[model samples]
Target: MTRFGSRIFWCFVTAAMIFSVISAAFPTKAEAITFTPNFTISSEAAVMINLDKDVTVYEKNPNKKMYPASLTKIMTALIVLDNVEDLDNTVYEAPLVVFDELYGQGASSVGIERGEEVTVTDLMYSLLLKSACESAGILAYHVGGESISNFVDMMNEKAKEIGCTGTHFVNPHGLYDPDQYTNAADMALIAQYAVENYPKFVEIATATEYDMQPTNYHEAGWAHIYHTNSMLNRSSSYYYQYAKGIKTGTLDESGRNLITMGSRDGNNYLLVTMGSPMYDADGNAVYLHYEDHKNLYEWAFENFEYKQLLQAGIEITELQVKFGESSDFVRLVTADNYSCMWLSTVDTNRLKETINVDPSLLNDDGTVTAPVAKGQKFGTYTLTLSGEEICTVDLVAQDDVTLSALAYNFDKAKQFTSSIWFKAALIITAVLVILYIIIVAASKKKRKKYRRVKKRRKF
Candidate 1:
């Protein structure tokens, strides 16, 4: 090629490359929305999970282990409920309702007096409502058949069974034990399981006040009690109405810790934070914990929502095939459920949906196959909002229908025969055949002419 021709070819190639890059850079649609927070904290780990869909809406250093404090009681309550056959069953406190230096000298107590003879129900209230170290010890003792060490073993074993890798339990009340540690993510999982699996536990955790009359050991009366969870009380004025009872934890070493649960409309959310310095001269740690959870939850609920891109168990459309057994179409159906987030409550409609599929699904004539099976993966259904992509689900066959296999094979054969390469081969063969015929004809004519000339000469 000439120098000028080479230069022109290179320019064309560069232009093609630039065009391809630009085309790929711009998507056919936008992406999903992201939920961002307004403030930050010093806790080593935190997590917010949506219970309804079992999805983690926000997470930061969720897997690092920290002291759980009284939040460990939530797990204690859960395991006891799971193993015990009867909830209303009654039991009296063992000869122990006395405080000792080993009980963490002056720690919170349920005020259970020795020989008070409280019921199992009363112990639960004391354990959860007041963060009573004594109640925890007593309950652990009873739950494990008088062995506090055995009860702690049960706590650790249960934590592992629930898919928690970074958690261990030393005491039921979450008192500081060098070995007692749990991360925000594992705490969230434990909280999630409690709320999902046990409703009775939920009631106990959320209740603000309960009345208890002394059994045969003391006089009957009602006692006003408050939840240790700061989020539940309005007079504390956190402004989180959806806020519900989980549990809160605090210790000199563990700092301020909390596992809070709440719901707005149809969404149930869980927030877990650990290892925050509580009761600082700067502010109240419990209040700060409440603030963090409230803000994180408000941000998540405001900025995200579940948008259904496709209906469950319903067929959306079909694929087009060219020369399949059936002349015109193969059926297509949405594979599964499709839901995703929008930027905020204001932009729910901004969410968009698109489908992607294998090009081979279409025939040369751009037609679909018939008789597609139900639940077959026809394509992917993606949901996007704002400029960010949120979620993608599968589009599947909704129903089953089969077309004639022989007819599909015959149509495919026709396509193969009509291919450009096949046509070129046929053309080449025809030209060769014609050339052979012409040469034979010319040779015969030449021979005849020679014989005539020879004969004339002889005569």
Candidate 2:
């Protein structure tokens, strides 16, 4: 090939290399709102999270304090399950005063007779499925050492333990009290705790109809109750197939509250809606909480999926190395796998990344020093979709780069010599030497002139 031909080829190659480096340094970025709810949520506060990935997909005033209503019983059931070891074997007798405490207050009940002996299973089912006020009182009275106030204290304590920040329970049965209130986010955490920790909790929460077995008070399936949540019922218009057992809360002040979980095709999500209007402007019954959750679940199930955007141990970029004899640079790869529930319509390659290496690890010239070990974390890169940060993963050394003692020492010596302090020292030393030489030269010249004067005797 001619020299001119080779020159043109090298110029093209240099341009391509520069372009590649620039592309990696500044990635293409697009910001799109991936999580958009299909319908307006009529609830005042709500949160929907993908339980499988633990990601918040939609939220509206999630932390706003609102009345939890009957949803407070979810925490009650959790405390009961925690205290009761043998759910079916242990028995507790109802006190006569317990019946009097719930009498004529417009509280819901399963008609427990005074002084009736009941098992833990019966009370649990009744408290959860039936939303029975007396069962909650009896369970709290026994579990709290016969003190109802003490049981509410236990509920509040458990609430704090499991990360409920804005929740305070005054009663276990969720009777409307001005002091009792919880937000959607805190309630979701409480419900999630019960769903995750207790297996039977889900069984009871999802049961459409629970038969209160022949007890000392009731006989022959006479005391059966259905779940308060309409989403779990197949015959109901608001029935959703993927919806599972969770608690429901409603009160005059609180409007309506619902905490439900949905699972479809290996994806599970938990939703909590609070402070929804029970009746529309026409004064007709409106189930906005249930419908909002149903729409949100369907939107999540249809549009999103888990996609592996980045894989670990794959070379992502190369970093120039100083004092490296074995290799001029080291390769950086992802430290861990980053899989996201990305939009199905978008391609993973379109997702932009912004890489950042630790400033301490990098040299002044934008290169890293040697002595890098494999799997050593050096930096992080954040992935974004439509301008929203999706996830950040650590960047690690792909292979070990041994440090060259000769090169490292040479660089150190060069740095020391070029430093301001060393340069100042050198200037002071040179000035001192020049001054001493001038003084010595003057003294030698004076002595020579004196000798010449002494030898001349005639002058």
Candidate 3:
């Protein structure tokens, strides 16, 4: 081979290397694909939401209204914690009429006898952990000024205040009533509010067992009261390691319901499952509600993770600037850091970001003007997954762009001189001036010729 052949071969190799580098730097847009986990649950309505991010992770029939059963006690307990001044000092006696109504309806009880003296603290434990219908009545009767109906009204009002749109309570015990119903979404929100506001609620709900102290009726004390939520008990087969304090509900008409909060790796999730099948085919009662919760928590903890998608002060994109002092463009970044729960296995390339720029900040030529201040919000970027928007972040200037007086004046002058109207006027003025000079010179020369002709004729 000649020397020229060797040079050509090296040039080809260099060209290939450059092409490879460019391809790696800016890859082609990947097809948008979302990872949807294949998980099945027995509950008719179920929902899971991230407590920290306040975003829905998974949902099915979340807005469908269903019977909440004993889950009503969650709101009942919340109101008691808010209005009741003292939990240990306040004492109330169980009324015979309350027991009569509860017993006739075949409601569950913590064995509160008529005229039995009990403190508010014991009743709360019984109300939440044991799902005692009578304990709820006593608390309501004492705190609601001897009217359980008024207490129910407060529960409904509190539900509305907590952003519950599909919930209404007719009784504190969550007894079956057509008017008393709540959806899975509403119940999850109610549980979230309860856990965030009252720490005692979580303590009582998560307890595996609580001993009721000595009361007037039972001098020795009530037997060891166990939590009705099976997930909290380690001995139970449905026990979940990450299960936290929440409430459960069951009724012949409503089947089984459960509201649960689980924490793993410093992340908390709220789950609600309603209307699970009460019985299997063999005429045996099945705890499908607990099973549903366990499945969801396990799947979520295994697959999802908290991810920081946008960080403050990190450049996201560059915007071209007109009449800028330091540079021709400026970097735009998020105003605040945003983190959300997302599937850990999902490819980050599939996440879509769309920037919506403010028209006032952009010129007609698709460039921004100078004098942009640092931290000024100029646009918004919406992050989406599978065509659904998850979050929106503000796009702010990463650095301050000072106004350049020299550049500004030069731009103004150049704009004026380059205008079509200015050029047309200048051409018209030049043409008029040239025509005047030519006409004046011609007239003077003709006059001179005429004078010379007159002199020749006289000679």
Candidate 4:
């Protein structure tokens, strides 16, 4: 071939290779979309979280302090569950003082006569499902070891432990008190903790109706304790199929409050709404809490989906491997798959992944060394939404990289020779050897001179 033709052919090949690399590095961009829910709600304060990832999906005045109403029983239940070791066997009696307080304050009750005997498990049903103020007092008095106030203190401490910063419990029944208040965000955290640590709490809260058998005081058995949260009652007009157990609260000062968990399409969500209007302008009662919950659930279900961001065994990124036996680069993958809630309508391109490698595992040139084991975690990949990290997974070696013995030894020798200590030692040895030679030579010359002088004297 002619020289010019050969040069042209090679030039075309080189350009094609460069183009291919560029395309691989930066694929075609997808149409960008913004995340902005187009729904409106009437709850004064609200927050929703994706349970699987613990990411906040929606918030409306989440941190604003407001009354939690009967929702306070959630913490009460948690404290009782923790303190009460035996639920089925341990029995508690209602103290007359508890009924006096309930009747005086006009708080709701499940009609427990003074000295009425009931099991701890039955009281839990009454406390959570029926929002029985008297039942809360009974549990508190007994679980608190004769002091309901001490139980209230435990409730606050548990709230703090659950990372509730804006919550303080003045009473276990969630009755109105100037000092008793919580924000939507804090309430969500408390609920999440209960659901995660206590599965029995979920079981009790989700029940539509629980029949309390005849106790010592009443032969006909207490009225069938029905759940106060309408979302869990299938017969209610506002019933939601996905709704799970939580609690409801209401007061003249706090309005209506609800915390509920819903699962659909493999996604579980916890929602908390507080301070909905109790009555409309007509002086008639309003059930805006249910409306707000239903709206939020519908919007979330329609717009959000669980997206698998990283799959196990699929290469995520390539890391340079120094002194590797088979290849100069190693592939990084996730040891387990990572999934997160994402907007179904938004463009997938909006999701960004940021990789952070450990400095200790990287060489001076920003490359990993040989002998990397198959599941070695050397870095992390964080998936983000608008610069906020939604999920993070470990970046692991995709396969084992055997160390090249020759290359490893050569690198070790080169490093040792280049090190300051080795250089200093070498310099010191050379100086010592030179000093010894000079001293020996000088000694030998002196001995020769002495021998010659002696011979002259003899002559």
Per-residue lDDT of model 1, residues 105-192, tens digit only: 6678756766666676777776787777776777777788777788889988899888899998988877778888888889988988
The TM-score between candidate 4 and the true structure equals 0.66
- Candidates in order have lDDT scores of 0.69, 0.81, 0.81, 0.82
TM-score of each: 0.67, 0.79, 0.80, 0.66
Per-residue lDDT of candidate 3, residues 1-459 (tens digit): 234444544454443332110101111122222234576789999888878777678888989989999999999899899888788888999987678678778888888889999989999999988899999999998888899888888998899899999998888998999998889989988888888889888888777788888887786655678888888888888878998867889999898998888999977889998999999999899987887888888888898877877777877788888778898888988777777677887776887988777766677897877777788777777777878766677888898887687887666656655766456545655666667678889989999999999999999
- Cα RMSD for candidate 4? 13.4
User: Against the hidden true structure, what lDDT does model 2 obtain?
Assistant: 0.81
Model 1: per-residue Cα lDDT at residue 408: 55
Ranking by lDDT: 4, 3, 2, 1
Please provide, for model 2 over 1-459, each residue's C-alpha lDDT reduced to its tens digit, 9 standing for 90 to 100.
234444543454443332111111222222223466656888999888788877777789988989887888888888888888998888888887677777788887888888888888988888887788889889999999989899899999999999988988998888888889888888888887888888989888878888877767767787878888888888999999999878787787899888889999999999999998989999998888888888888888998887777788877788998778799899999877777666575677877988877776676798877777888777787787778787777888898999897987666566656767556656765666677779889999999998999989757
Off by over 4 Å in 1: 1-34, 38-44, 83-89, 95-101, 104-106, 114-116, 215-223, 264-267, 279-286, 300-304, 311-322, 325-333, 340-389, 395-459
Q: Which stretch of 10 consecutive residues in model 2 shows the poorest summed lDDT? A: 19-28
* Ranked candidates (TM-score, high to low): 3, 2, 1, 4
Give the clashing residue pairs of candidate 3, or none. Answer: none
Top candidate, metric TM-score? 3
